[model samples]
Target: MFLLLVQAISLLLVPPLQSYHLDNAFGNPESVWNSLYYVVLLLLFTGAMLIIVRYKVNWLIQAIMAVAVLSTLVYVLFGLAVLLVPSVDPLIAGGVSVVLSLLLTALLIVYPEWYIIDTVGVLVAAGASALFGISLAILPTIVLLVILAVYDYISVYKTKHMLKLAEGFMDLKMPIMFVMPRRWGYSFMENNKGLPAEGAEREAYFMGLGDAVMPTMLAVSANAFLSAPPLLGFVNVPALGCILGTLVSYVVLMYIVVELKKPQAGLPFLCTGAIAGFLLGCLAAGVRPF
Candidate 1:
């Protein structure tokens, strides 16, 4: 439920971000090569993160992630501030965004509570999805999703390095992952000591922020690039289908998680569902599925 809500909210932010021309934080909008650049950058960052974890340079990784989180928050917040008050000065809005982002980052670094991490994680995920969604067109976004889904599968199942990454991230308690407590009394700080015992009852659930961000990249792109009439006032038929499909897959993913009590590669199911839903939506809307 929480993850779905975050995805929906991220989708909602797309049009506004597009209106403000705030998407594509990292690439040239006119070039078809942007997708390739993005993929390469992603791989490089992943390698860097793995090296950071391998070397136990927790503070450096956390600092790098904090800067990323702050920048995205400011991007989204500045756009939102301008949208709410069109006459507001960009400088003032930007200053406010910086301050807010700084405070949020401070909270994450100083306190590092589960709820705080989750809240900030959602905002960062939303901002990133919106940015990337508008940056890439349909075909490129599709390519990105397919590549990421494959990479996620390999990282999790074949190499199993993703598991190591997860363990390392748990130690930092950064907003890179969302935390869902299964029990009333759960302490993220305490749980960070180590991975859970194999057969022990888990006290909380953890899902990568990427799982929410990736499918949402498609939803935001659909909303931005497709001209289909709105199916429900806010989203077009195709985008809505993508969102619904993701939710359906999420339900299935959760079922497997709860039933089997094991870690799963979320992007495989999520990306597949999103792509299938997108194609179905395109068909219903009489748009090309490419």
Candidate 2:
């Protein structure tokens, strides 16, 4: 029950990075380069993870996990603090941001509890979501989501690289993915026997943050760029639709994980839901489908 609440709260606290990335991409082609850079980072991360898994070096895994957690904390703090701080200059903001982020990161390195991981995850998720949402327009977000879904399918089912990625990441004990334990004193490190036995049902669950972030990118993008009337709390038709669709998709996915006892690539379901909702929103707003 607590874990379930944590999941919901985590989603609420962290906005995905997709929206901010989208906004930047919409602003300039350079922004697309920036997005591509992250992909490179992810690929690099994937490679390192493979190496870590292949060799079974526990200490290096822990070190990488620490670095990832710390880096995420930096971005999370900087993004949120920039909004509240007095100075608007990028330089001053950057300095203060670095200091604060490092402080938080240092704290996590010293002591990492469940609360700390979840808090950092929420902060990072929000930063990423806002960044991508603002940069990506409706069409781009849709395209990105579709492309990612296909990639996820290939990675998870065909190439089988994604499962490897998941296994390696789980060993790191990072919050890049949602972590839930079915029972008390369950150690992710010890129980990390691999990605749930390939089809076996398990009480605990771990979902890559990417799964959550990718779909929400469309939601935030639709809201930020679309000119339609606000449907809920100043968000426009597209935004409302995207949010509803995402929640619908999340619920469905969670249900499948819990009740259906099946393994599935989440992006396909999420993207489908978001696209359908976006179209419906376009119709409601009297906008012709392009």
Task: Give the CA lDDT, 0 to 100, for residue 285 in model 1.
Answer: 92
lDDT of 2 by residue, 181-278 (tens): 77898665556555676568675687776776777666666666567787535467765676667668778888877775556788887778878887
How big is the positional error of residue 243 in model 1, measured in Å on the Cα after superposition?
0.2
> What TM-score should be assigned to candidate 2?
0.74
Model 1: per-residue Cα lDDT over 83-145, one tens digit each: 678788878988998999999989988888888888888888888888888887888888888
Candidate 1 Cα outliers beyond 4 Å, as residue runs: 26-32
The lDDT values for all models are 0.82, 0.62
Best by TM-score: 1
TM-scores of the candidates are 0.93, 0.74
Estimate the Cα RMSD of every predicted model relative to the unseen true structure. Answer: 1.9, 4.9
